[model samples]
Target: MYLGVLALTAFVLTVFLLVYLGLFLGRLPFLQLDRTGVVLLGAIALVATEVVPLSGIGEVVHLPTLALLFAFMVISAQLRLGGFYDWVVVWLDRRALAPPVLLGAVIAVAAALSAVFSNDIVCLAMAPVLAQLCRARGYAPLPHLLALACAANLGSALTLIGNPQNMLIGEVLRLDFGDYLRVAALPVLLGLLSTWVIIAGLSRGHWLEASASLLPSALGRAGEVGVPLDRWQTFKGLTVAALLCAAFLWAHWPRDLLALAGAGLLLTSRRLHSRQMLGLVDWQLLVLFVGLFIVNHAMQQTGLPAQAVAVLADEGLDLQEPAPLFAASVLLSNLVSNVPAVMLLLPVAQAPVDGPLLALSSTLAGNLLLISSIANLIVVQAAARQGVVIDWRAHARVGLPVTLVSLVIAAAALLPWRA
Candidate 1:
């Protein structure tokens, strides 16, 4: 009996470490596995070892979070398919706004959309188009792309539907939508403003590439951008999104169920095929959610995380407290990305105020470093295709300040809630 318990504990610990190692490194060494693959393998190993039985996965994984994530993905897919994201960028390019004003416009649109759509999807659909637009307008894609990434991450904190981790926090904590918006509004607004200031300051005198304008090669990647703006389709997507947001604020229904109903309505459209809409759903991320759910549950069941929290509390670093939770969230978020960090720290977030703190800190802190948020990576990758390179040093120069200020604003705003 003793040997069996010891072996099981060791197995769980080893698996947990392996999974996080892959997460932190963004890929496993020998297996060459990506983030999703690593977690899926870890969960499969645990179940194969009979640590977390397959049948009990329903209890371990939170279905509502997955459902909510999928539903929102569908909603965003609708907009992407309708070319709303492309149209926004094309509209901005056609405006012929000043360089500073252009940057601000991108920030505003990205942040506003991210507040409602999933941030990753927002970036995925917009970055390619925005990159081409910047190049065509005789501007380097760096400042504008950075604005999009930073603004999306910053704005995703405004509401639960904005990002995956926020949705998870909301579903797990059962937080009211209106209430969370009230908590996050001030900080998110301040963060978006800071993002614009930092980018605009850093990009002064480099806004327009005078000699590069009108290069035919700039639009070479237009094929990768989202579809053209179908006004009717875009209208349909907007209406559904508005209704979903209203329902989230006032309706008594479960958020996941409400979002799914909205998704169903969009999917049933005669103009858009169900497969086309479903194809954009990001099945990998949904599977990653499932895998992380099981692995984190297995970790929780091992009782080690609980014991560690107890020890930390005795050591005067109680995670339940606002300051420590806020700091830890920022650190963990930058370390292994926000979703995994949120999953690791979620157990201690029992207080009503913890939801807003965790969501804001985790999502906002990603702006500190390059590739810390998937939005950052998406923007960077999209720009690289457009002949622009934004290295880590460049990102840190601007992102570091924005992250520090945002976290400070968030802490000041949220800590008062606990009192």
Candidate 2:
């Protein structure tokens, strides 16, 4: 029996390492698989080898997190298809504001919207529009695009429903919605301001450079692909979104259930096809979550995490404490990406302060690199589609400092509340 357990442990560790390696590298080294593919492959291997029973798959997956994520994706899809995001971009672009003011506006809008919606979705919807807007206005799009990504990440840290990992953190910890926001609001606000300052300062003289040559082709392509603003649909999406936020704050209703209901309401539409809304859902990300949950649960069954925690405790690095937890959150978040890192750390988050600390640390750490967050990648890819190349160096120049400053600010703001 001991030997059998040892073999299972070894198999689980091997699969875990290989899966995380793919996550860290964004692909399997030479294989055509992305992170989602690699994770799915590892999970299939586990099930096929009987390391995790097929029937136990349902036991391992966190249904609430998955349900909440799907609900919010549907909500975001509704807003995206309704052209709400495009309206915001066009509204901002027509303002004729000066460069710094315009940058601030972009940051502010992105931050606010991201606080309510999925940061990744917010970036996905806004990046291309912002890029084309910059091209048309003869301004550099890199700064605005980076600001959108950074601000979205920072602001999403403010609320429970803002991003997937935050949702997971909230659900696992059973954190009070209003209380978490009270703790997170200040730091998130300061972080957004810091993002604006850094990006604005970095793009000082080059903000207004003409991209006339790049504009026509990009603008034409953008128009072809862009969703036009539908006033009625936009109003409906916004109304539902507002009510959902209210429900999260005021009602004692299960958040996942309420969000699911909201999604259902949006789906029962005459003009917008359900297929169109469903098509916008990030099915790949949902699958990735399922795969990671199964793998992590199997690893937990091996008792390795508990032993490792014991070792760390013996060394005086108690993970239950806020400081070490904060440090670990940042390191692991950047190492394996935020969602999986949060899943790994969820078991050790015991203190009252640990929930907010985990949420803030993991979310803020996403600003450390372009590869660190899906929001950043979305922005980068969206800009690339419009003939603007924002490479790693370009992103890091802003990301590193923004991450450091935001982390410091969050730490300072949360220090008084630390247990």
CA RMSD, predictions in order = 2.2, 2.4
Give the CA lDDT, 0 to 100, for residue 327 in model 1: 88
The residue-by-residue lDDT of candidate 1 on 1-419, one tens digit each, is 99988888889999999999899998998787999999999999999987999889899999999999999889898998998988888777767777799899999999999999988888888888888777776777788888889999998999999999999999999999999999999999998998888889898888877576543333324564557679999999999999999999999899999999999999998889999999888999998999999899988988999999999999999999988999899999988889999999999998888999999999999898997999999888888887888899988988899999998889889867787
RMSD of 2: 2.4
Candidate lDDT (C-alpha), each: 0.89, 0.89
Enumerate clash totals for all models, in the order shown. 0, 0
- Candidate 1 global lDDT: 0.89
Model 2 Cα lDDT, one tens digit per residue, 1-419 = 99988888999999999999998888997899999999999999999998889998988888888899999898889889888898788888767667688789998999899988999999999998888788777777888888899999998999998899999999878998999999999999988998988998898878765634323323333454388888888888889989989988999988988989998999999999999999999999999999999888888888999999999999999898788889999999998899989999999998888899999999999999888999999999999999999999999999999999999999998798764
TM-score of each: 0.96, 0.95
